[model samples]
Target chain A: MIALVQQDGPLRIEITEGVIEPLPFAIPTFQDESGTAGAIADEISRVIAADLSGTGLFREIPSTSFISSVTNFSAPVAYPDWKAVNAQALITGAVTESGGQITVKFRVYDVFSGAELGQGIQIVGTTAGIRRIAHKVADTVYSRITGETGYFDSRVVFVSETGPKNARSKRLAVMDYDGANVTYLTDSQSLVLAPRFSGSGDRLLYTSYETGQPQIYVMDVGTAERRALGTGGGNMAFSPRFTPDGQGLIFSLEQGGNSDIYRMDLQGGGLQQLTNSPAIETAPSFSPDGTQIVFESDRSGSQQLYIMGAGGGEPQRISFGPGRYGTPVWSPRGDLIAFTKQNEGRFHIGVMRTDGSEERLLTASFLDEGPTWAPNGRVIMFTRESQGSDGAAGLYSVDISGRNLRRVPTPDSASDPSWGPLQN
Target chain B: MKKITIAVMLVSALALTACSKNRFNGQDGTAGAGTIQPGSANDPSSPAYFNQTIGDRVLFAVDQSTLSAEAQSVLTQQATWLSNNPAYSAIVEGHADEQGTREYNVALGARRASAVQSFLIERGVAPNRLKTVSYGKERPLAVCSEESCYAQNRRAVTVLTSAAGS
Candidate 1:
């Protein structure tokens, strides 16, 4: 329950309580000499409005309801006109084009308090960059008001699927986390299962069936060039994951009909077998310190989770609950392990402490698994498949508290989401 | 409870048919037929006591690396069969539901196969004769959008590459 009251000098402010209503804001159209430029300004404002309003965190006042027009972009905003419409905040901008470059200048005002919040200017390569420029402006305003970092600039990498159920085609696609700027990194002809970002978000490691067998491949995000890491033989190799340091890869290799967990140096040519058992052991994720690995195994006649030292000692079973657990990924924070749990025909995405205690089921549905941590470790993004006439798989994000479940937008069906480390 | 009963019945039917198929296949010299004596456990008439096919797999719930009681029973039967035919070596391939992250699913698959291996060892089957690997949702016998298909995909399969009586 925070409220802002304006004062003079550097837009001084004070907070109050009692009314926690949304801070009213007005975004007037940016003045432009050309109609196209005006249209671009209008669209940018619309995107900003959409982004802010969708969060359920802001209230936008309509210009039609305004008492006065913002005709002069450079002139001081008539605070009374904005206050008359009950808009606590006012945003004004102008678009200017020179030598094939577009520049947008914008300012924020606290209308009721009659003070300016901030002002910014952005130059873009083309009019297309206008939207992103607007996004940056909106992010600045929102952060100033809410006191939190904005996610508008981040991107998401997921597996985009098509074709029928039996022979689905998958490719790696990356876009703004909000589903804009969709770009496919790999051609859809190959079957790409999971695409996980390296620590730097500049590269990706994923499983591809391009060679008719599941093999791990690493691709540069910028160049889209891929190189096979391990020399995959007749045996299938799948589920390649990067060590926290990004210097080694942990993956499952099927040799002589047996699948075992192996770690290989990303640069050097040494493969180390991490687990040697008759039971299937795969999906190894390193602890933050790279000292222990948490993975799923069926060593106890059921598929349960186990943790062991990175050097391949005996594993201690961590899951003792009512159902089977799989896909244990260590959180980047090193406090919990996220996994998928199946019980009584329902699949769940859950997290438990590193020792397998304090298991909390974050989501439950017909089919939900694959929990990847947000770069900040506050939220998890996973794929949820609904069962019905329109049974489809899509990417979904949920707070670790099991609240704020929201669908991440994608052009087609998406799954196996891997949240990259925060962008630089 | 009703669903569980039906599932039990279905499992029984599948086990009976699987056992008959194993006998027929063994007689055909896919592998020499070795008598699979039911170990001391539950009722002999129960499907759990029947000798299961050596090279078969059991489905798991999505993301579940834990073996169900049904899966444990199947592995027990497999262990008895393996011990009786000591020359045979097996590879357990673990898999996961397609709904998961693939790397984690591979680990989950490995857990599933390892669960079977430990169960076989507890039942007197030598651990050295068995090997485990995880497919992690890479291979699918049934490809559909339905839960049934996903359940079948999440599994650990014991593949007998060598004949038991060789």
Candidate 2:
């Protein structure tokens, strides 16, 4: 927890500098110009503030600390009053409703410079999606101030877990990036794991233990409709991911006793085996550009990561550290691959360059696995299960710079988060 | 007392004769020989017998699929039991301890299950009567984080089904 009005310096924060002091910012409740939208306008303003403050990059200045309040939508700038309260950034907005739709307009201001950082913009949406409208507002402000895309408007598909560790039941679920609007996709009668999002963010691919077999299934997110992906026919298959184009899938298929990587054309129904190995090979992920794939294999007698072309061929080993690596997820930016590493009984969430250099472990825990990259490629979310008879699993996220580690709030014990792209 | 004991032995012999005829189609084989109740742990042909006497599961070491001598011993008995019960098909469920990543544990469990499958095939069990699935670290028999529990969690269980066998 950080104080609302704190300061480090006026210098521009370089993201690569690692953990820095939180910048102080203030967002006054959007003025309800129509008076009819007062409640919703305040709600929208609160959501935007929560979205920005949750990043740990900015701290909120409580309304009680404000020296002056602007009750007008087009009020002249009172930058001196904002700077007097130690505010480095300020956001002011107004909301109005006509019939069923509401319009929200906001401006981002650099209090130190006494100028609006970006031109004021207005967003129009229905009252039913007020929170989404707020998230979009925060995203615009974040992009203008940080010079990076925002992840606030995205949704995460994950495995919602229930019951005890030994007798647990898992259901496929989707929720807002901030853990709101939870809607389950499957019942708890069967076990599910590792739900991945399509590039468009409207479809999902996951593994389910239906038919007394572990098989992959692709689902239409809006309809909750699904069908088994018949890549392996009568064999066991799991750990599926969609290609960048969403026209193909890469997954693991087990035959006889060996598990290997496989690809399937979603539209043409053509299947291709990507790896042929007697040793264990599974958990394959495609590069952002879809030309390369990173996967884990024990072909060298232990679990290590290897890179191969999207089309099958010989794989070049990439992971050379002392620890074992698995669940390698390519960053949305296509530059880094995040993975789960285990060494000497401890687990870590780590990231490495595509060529396996600059290997940095972002988090260490009793159990941390299944890293999912945020749309901006600046943060990674994963599952962290505690160690004990009563230990439980939960979702957590960390900045790519390895700071601001926080548990993502969820309705129940959850794991295996796959973040979708920013909503349109 | 001696006369009654002789009479009882004759009746038991009659019951064993009925069992040798495969009267129950040899599917579950829960019916016992002679005085033992059907499906009881003491029943020689019952799945309970296979579970308790022939061993329904084989344990694996951390991150290893190489069968230990003890595991092979249990699997050998399982093979003989399956061979005798021709009406049963087996689904070998391979599992791993909660110490590894989800998908890697899955691949490791597959290796363990395949090891057992190979051993069973070597022992003359029909390959068609066998199928394998790796649960990875999704399911666990023991919930603790210690080696004692992990040893039990890392196992491959041969679950018998009543489906017709070729």
Candidate 3:
């Protein structure tokens, strides 16, 4: 039965399972409304186009292909000109600079229907945060066009590596989702690994080896002040992750020569042992709702994935595959879990349901591990080390559908990336 | 025949010099691995001597930590030396081959070190004299990807330190 599709508005494009043709969109360089706007207008427009094109769902028509240009920000778009060029969607924006602050406003139109999708909104921020303002605008347009949350406005906390493999140095680094505006949080005096951001992205949790042994530490990303998590009690702790609400942390602690998972209340200083087995248990990630946790354990004599209650109880094994699985991260959308699997001399990044069914491998290489999700759950970034003795580690991201695989730019080798939530 | 005799005499003279020089100074052209100093009984450097000559590390099979007969023999020698020199304490650093995940390798390394520690204790070494730490695959003695290098990396090393009165 063919159902008549109703167009909710000009921006609503119905997506179905079939051969999908790329949508053509156009964004003329944004106009400068004030003399002080300088080159920000053009830079912001280019960034927005790049962001949209990176998704692989839309193709940006070069400005040379446009029949007309948007010289004024407030003027209505000439729909006939865009329709003539076969451009289905068009975005127009203006930039103004005043005092030490900059403001940007943009509008999106469905040229085919000749209707405005939404009213133009203005974003104001400090001149230093112009890129952030641009990202915010692009996120707005992306959400409106695709009807999905945008991940471009998020950040990633990862381990920046340098030097040789035997004596490598690692520091915690943060950057924009597109690998821009990088800032190092640690001085590399100690080895850092597996940095995870809080729900609000105000703080970070990672494992550091400052005291001659791996220990968990939490730091305020803005202030750079840090403190050891929980009382060390003469034990080693590592593989840390924040709880869903950011009020607690789940990590692996080695005591008496055995490793197990534990949960700690950050606000109340309460500690609870989640798993009490002689076998190894580590890499615990909370479900989006904070009711369940999916982690890796070796109780069955080989590494495998398992799920248990947040408060801790009997854990039912989720992975029964042929190879070992580790570093399981639940998707923000609460539909799938991403993990690193080692099988037949090769490592791969894979995803599976909460019940461990319909497993799909996204990437395969000599060594690919530590998969983290984008804010929108559409992409995953992981550590891929080359083969042989001279191999180096670097960060790579792939769309969840296994397309658009790209290397994230970094000055040195990088690993253990944890993408943060979208900035408010 | 005269030239051959002279050549053998020159070679014998050079070998004699090398042997006398090594016997007096304990120095050789080759360095690293098995560079030991000849000493008397109950030498003040006995702990270092044991570490350098008797071997302080034992290798393990791929992912298994079960002690091999050769590894057990080394541990037996270590136990005897530790009992003879009670003032020295040992730290067993467990390490794993870079063939598995980081977290699992760490656990596997810890198990290997614990195996060494248990064997030492069972052989009459004081439990308090031994401490265990798992470096996982972080610290590798050999930096290669082949099995020969991996065999060297998957080992537990016993590092001895002087505890003075203890």
Best by DockQ: 2
Off by over 4 Å in 1: A1-24, A33-36, A83-89, A110-113, A118-125, A231-235, A253-262, A268-339, A350-361, A388-390, A421-424, B1-166
lDDT of 1 by residue, B21-125 (tens): 433112222323464433312323222233233336777765555678888877877877677665456667777766554555655676687777777888998
DockQ of each: 0.10, 0.22, 0.12
Better of 1 and 3 by lDDT: 3
Question: CA shift at A296, candidate 2, in angstroms?
Answer: 0.9
Give one digit per residue, the lDDT tens place, for model 3 in B50-122. 6555678899998788899999998998899889888777778899988877777777788898899999999
From the highest DockQ down, the ranking of the candidates is 2, 3, 1
Which stretches of candidate 3 lie above 4 Å from their native place? A1-20, B1-48, B164-166
Task: Please list the residue runs of candidate 2 whose C-alpha ends up more than 4 Å from where it truly belongs after superposition.
Answer: A1-13, B1-35
Model 2 lDDT at residue A186: 78
Deviation (Å) of A38 in candidate 3: 3.1
Better of 1 and 2 by TM-score: 2
Q: In candidate 1 chain A, where is summed lDDT lowest over 10 consecutive residues?
A: A8-17
